[model samples]
Target: MQKSFLIVVIVAIVGGLAIHQFVPALSASIAFFAGAIIAALLFKLLPSALSQGDGEYSGPMMTLYVGNLPYRVHEGEVKELFSQYGEVCSVRLVRDRKTGRRKGFGFVEMPEASAQQAMAQLNDFVFQERTIKVREAKTQDSDSTEKNPV
Candidate 1:
């Protein structure tokens, strides 16, 4: 918090000076406000930048749903692609039980932080001439309908 505040103050002062040079009529307050806004925007991006890259992040594992995959792609292929972002715990590509054919989707399990990075980069990414989507898996209710008897 302090770091961000310092950055905002410094940027605001510098920006105010620059603006005063270019436009003498503009108030210093307005110039500082503009710089402060820019600084805040940059600060928002800081977390995302640090989130990417290898680091020991202690958190629960996350499961992600991958969709719109090419039928030709295998589980290993998907795992390999996702592993680039982090350690992939597991990858399971769904298939039709009756025919044992590909269903063109899968689930990938990994650390939460890495999973976030993967989702950001992989969502809407094109692979093998097809666009793919990556998102958090929707968990089913623990109290299943069968247990309650509708």
Candidate 2:
């Protein structure tokens, strides 16, 4: 499939040059070939943007909402729960900073592929007698709405 696309691109460029007998038509043909080459490259590579980039998303982080955790669930337990899917880089239970108690939610970080796998497999799996809600962690910037102070 990719080879076919490459061949088509080369043909377009060659055809453009062959038809370059008239100056105006030649320029348009050259421009069209250039556009086709770029478009083909982008089509072949667009899917990789979701998984590969300039370290923009190294590991996929997940935010989980846990319920009925026996009021004794700690970071360790969260790590243990998610460890079944992949290496747990970090587990942070949301807590009242002053009170230092779990707020029924937490975040876990793992490799991007592993995180995605975990989410698909564990989104509603039961744990510690309660169903959990697991998904990609949304950054603070993403959650906040821009307010235009008029």
Candidate 3:
């Protein structure tokens, strides 16, 4: 398995380089697709190939539920605020679908350690005239229960 995989990788690399050198017009597009293919193979295929147990892979990134964001707060503002603690991967400010308005809540993704630090410092922290609530985002089931509240 390992030998075949290595052979395939070598063939792909050689083919890509040959195309890049001989076909200048198509090089850019080829490079773009080649990079994407390599990334998918490494991140997606390699993990499953290596894992022998049940297919469960939890990444190190943590997503936080941010509440009480002032209606004015945007993704960049939230990212800047959270970046003080650690690297902020993404910030998503939830918006109303019908009216296209800010929903006063959002989700932020960061490394696990950074998330903990941000949550500890920012939970209930007053920002933009509102006390912001920061905590780990709940899974779908828990989120539904909270909303329905039976």
Candidate 4:
């Protein structure tokens, strides 16, 4: 897919150059607009469009600590619940590494305003027979790299 898009972009650029040889003024304007569009896509659109992995997100966002989640509740369900308030950037349910069991808590990432709203509404809200808690995630002083420090 990317290869195809690249091919199209190259073709457009080549065609624009050919047009420039025939009509310099018209093609200069066209080239200017085309460059702007390409620059916008590359600098603005591309990063956000492709930032779907792990903890990647664009714009101002907040991470909420969602506690007391039902062990059986799916990530999609949590995402749906938060999406009602605002766009959910990501939902990550913490799990035990050894047994792969959900730890009954998770982190939800969303826009700052949306997170505040969700924290207001969802905290202490009952879902799946559990009263959950939602609040701004406390930033830890330690990072993963030091987990197995010798």
Off by over 4 Å in 1: 1-58, 142-150
Q: Name every residue pair that clashes in candidate 4.
A: none
Worst 10 residues of 4 by lDDT: 48-57
Ranking by lDDT: 1, 3, 4, 2
Error of 3 at 117 (Å): 0.6
What are the lDDT figures for the candidates, one per model? 0.84, 0.66, 0.82, 0.81
Clashing pairs in 3: none
lDDT of 4 by residue, 57-76 (tens): 45799999999999998899
Number of clashing residue pairs, candidate 3: 0
lDDT of 3 by residue, 42-126 (tens): 6455655544443332569899999999999879999999999988878999999999999999999998998999999999999
Candidate maximizing TM-score: 4
Could you tell me how far off, in angstroms, the CA of residue 116 lies in candidate 1 after the best superposition?
Answer: 0.3
TM-scores of all candidate predictions against the true structure: 0.56, 0.51, 0.59, 0.60
lDDT of 3: 0.82
Worst 10 residues of 3 by lDDT: 49-58
Name every residue pair that clashes in candidate 1. none
The digit string of per-residue lDDT tens for model 1 on 1-150 reads 455566667867787788777988888888777777766676577755533443545579999999999998998899999999998888999999999989999999999999999999999999999999999997766447647766
Error of 1 at 5 (Å): 53
